[model samples]
Target: MKHLLSTHDLDVPTVAAIMNVADHMSEINARSVPKVPALLGRTVASVFFEDSTRTRVSFETAAKRLSADTMSFSASTSSVNKGESIRDTIETLSAIGVDAFVVRHASSGVPVSVTEWTDASVVNAGDGWHQHPTQALLDAYTITRELGTGNTLAGVRVAIVGDIKHSRVARSNIDLFARLGARVTLVAPGMLLPAGLAGPGITVTDALDDVLPDVEVLYMLRVQRERMDAGLLPVGGEYSARFGLDERRARMLSGDAIVMHPGPMNRGIEMVMDPAELPGSRILAQVRNGVSVRMAVLFRLLGDGQLGA
Candidate 1:
């Protein structure tokens, strides 16, 4: 538990322990001041080689809420623009006493590479089509909170829809959900899902309608147009008409099923119906849980070691 490189590194008891700590963090978030002295005098550095909105801000806010000193590093403005290597940049920060690094990079294993250069604990925010551990943690926390499932997701059916080939969130969720005892079905077009993803506790399908009736959680992923160079989509409304969670398709889901999207959702593409208006949507709940889950992670890595399983 020295570093959080991937969800695959965590087991059931460990996940439950982290979720219990996050439950406390969630309570702190509900308070008027919403600040704690748990991480006083510790410093957290957010080094993002890729552009991000929700993750970067969430980590910074989590650090602040725990009273930890925080600094931000972006590739565009840093010495990276001057051709300084990532090792050099991290070594320089390490020399100044950074306690932990929350790293997001376009490269897959940048966070793991960073651990070789510094003694600071590394938390992977998001890597290129790799694991986004914190996002999956928050998602699991949100589901548990909304469904009253405690920390175990046994017998809960979750369907992750769209863009599986390019989504780090989907990868992390599949691992975390399966570990927490949930049955996961990946719903995407043939071109979107990578080969060799189906196995025990997991299934894949191109037809969303076939799985909608039984799924308790419908997690929609955005189409990563930036990641694809050529056109992977068909012309006009064909993709949406088949795959999008429009009002008509929304009605086909189980009555208590919840709709979830990570962020920056495409209005008419992946999600046609307004997520804010959806009755069982946990989109905003996921955002709030992001702060709590990150706080728990920081506390575990940098605070007292009591929370570790």
Candidate 2:
């Protein structure tokens, strides 16, 4: 509960606690003003080495809602452009009395390193292909809210389809969903599956149809084109054609099954999902939950529920 570096570090109770707080935060969003002074004197520093819009803005808005001052330091305009190290930037920010840090780096373990170097508690927005803990939590919250209690994963099947090798979201969700009692199936072409992935009650498959009928949720991830050049994923249209979840694939699921995609969705690359259509789509819901979920995270990390009240 100290620093959220990875989902693997959180026990089931800790995850449940955060989700409960997120439910409280969801209630706050329905209020007239939707602002609190719980973190009035506190400050949150965001150090984003990677390009992002949703995660960064969500954290900023969350801190603001709690009345915490926010400082955003990205690679483009910072001393990082001058070749300054992450350690130097972290120390500089920490010396200024930051209460917490929300970091997203291109390299895995950077958040963990930041936690070691600074007194500020660190929340990992993302780290390479490692984890996006907050995203996983929000997705979990969305599922719980939609399905209600006892609707956890126990007998429900979930298919996480797309670039698993480069998807930090997939990695985090895989762990989180499994921990919450869901049966997870990671579907992707051979090269896209993460190396050394096994156990923890997950099944790996290249065939979409194999897991479709039983799946209650189809979680899609955008294929990382950048990883193709780096050799982590294969190139081309053929790969997507074979694996992408189009209308045809969408029809294969149960009538009540839901479809979810974390934003910056590849309209044609990941799936042929039309934003205007798709009845059970929860993509927009994820964005809305991001604000409330992040608000809960900031409130808890800052040591009070008043901020989100």
Candidate 3:
């Protein structure tokens, strides 16, 4: 729990502890004075090398809720525009007393490299296709809340639909969900799915229909057009025609099945179904839980660790 670079870095007990803390963090929203003094003297730095709205603001809210001071830095207007290298930027930030770094970088493993340069605890907000640990954590919290207590998704089948090749969220969710005792089924076209990603408890398949009926959770991912280096699909219409989760496909789920998407969804591309209107859609809850889950993470990493103890 020292650093959250990847979901692969956390064991089952630590992951559960963080989730329990998030449950307590959620309760703070109900209090007359919600703010905690846990991170009173600490400081967190959010360094974004890519564009963001939700992730950045949620982490900022999380830090502030715990009474931690934050230094928000984005590469778009910073020394990065002056041709300053990431190394120099790290050195500059290190000159200030930064307690933790919540980093979102375009290149994979950049957060791990940041850890090498500073004593700050590194939480990988995202690192290209490498991982987004907190995103996975929030999604886990959302599912647990929806299912209620003593409801472990041990044998529950989950189908992660849509883009997989360039999604750090998808990669992190797959690993984290498996670790939390869910059976993960990855469904995407051959070109869209990552190669050599299968393991014992996980299965990779292009047959979406086969995976649909049995899935307890149908997680959709947005196709990242910004991350594309070359032409993978002919067109959006063609891609959707072949693989999108349309209304017909949405009907395949069981009565208690839930539909999920990490936001900024593409209407007709990855998910043809109206995710917001779906009864089982917990997308908005994922966004709210992002703040609480991150609050839990910040408190654990920077706080006194007695909030949920």
Candidate 4:
């Protein structure tokens, strides 16, 4: 694959290959120095049109860990604020010899469009409510690590909860989990789910409590209040009441089950209780693994595209 645009573009072997590379990256991250010369002299630029803390910092750290040079871009402070187009910004950076770009935009397909303006390989960090490939990668890695079931998530019961209609993470995970042979159930209010969302090995439900006991991975999603229509959630209290992962609902999870959440969370709304109290919570693990997953992606795209080569 020339570009990491969406999970829809990946098959099983490609996913496994990337995750194997992540295993190598994860080892590097565990070392005292946590540094490598794999990507020395190569430049990876982060061009983000949206605000982010985890993804932006995570990608920068990943590139640095591999000894790749990183360029940071913020739309608010860049020429974008001065009316320069995205094409101009990307072209400008490409002219300076960027080897790869980690692009995140509030608009869907921005990364795909960026490919036209630059010769560098492009990785979609997150775009609109379309896809967040790297997040899904880390999540799958964390799950597979926990299960000790090797690379595939086959037969794993994963319930992705909350704001499905507006979650790029949810969309990416559903495709990936299904590809890896996992059973995925989307838990949300009816309107939160996309209309006619269906696929093999996929399930949908509005009842979180009913889905809780059965799923091995209970993934909580941030409720995107900004993306919702007015009536979908009034006051946010009701949604929390029904779908939030409170202590009581968390107890429904079986022993050895795990809880996950993609970050910058809506604490009171998406999760009524602190994740610290949850026995098998993988939220911090997800963040820790994110850097390694991103490092693997950068290696695959910008380096020789081989593991341990």
lDDT against true structure, model 2 = 0.82
The residue-level lDDT of candidate 3 at 183 comes to: 87
Q: Is candidate 2 or candidate 4 better by lDDT?
A: 4
Which parts of model 1 have CA positions greater than 4 angstroms off? 227-229, 305-307
Model 3, position 93: C-alpha lDDT score = 89
Per-residue lDDT of 87-116 in model 4, one digit per residue for the tens? 999999999989999999999999999989
For residues 1-309, write the lDDT of model 2, one tens digit per residue: 567788886667666677777787778777898888878989999999998988999999999988999999999989899999999999999998899999999999999999788988899999998899999988887877766753255655788888887889999999889888888899988877767777777899988876877888888887777776687655556656777777777778888888888888777777665855877688888888888888888888787522222
lDDT, candidate 1, 168-271, per-residue tens: 99999998998898999998878888887877789988889999999999999877755443677643377687778988888888889998999989888788
Candidate 4 residue pairs in backbone clash: none
lDDT tens digits by residue: candidate 3, 1-309? 467888887677777778888889999955898898888888899999998878999999999988999999999979899999887888788888888889999999999999888877888999988899999989888887887733245666888977788789999998888878888999887888787778767988888888888888889888776533357653687777766888888788788899888988888887787876577788888998999999988887776423223
For model 1, the local distance difference test gives: 0.89
Residue 128 of model 1: what lDDT? 92
> For every model shown, what is its TM-score relative to the native structure?
0.97, 0.93, 0.93, 0.97
Q: After superposition, how far is residue 208 of candidate 3 from its true place, in Å?
A: 1.8
| Predictions: Cα RMSD each | 1.4, 2.6, 2.3, 1.7
Whole-model lDDT values for every prediction? 0.89, 0.82, 0.83, 0.89
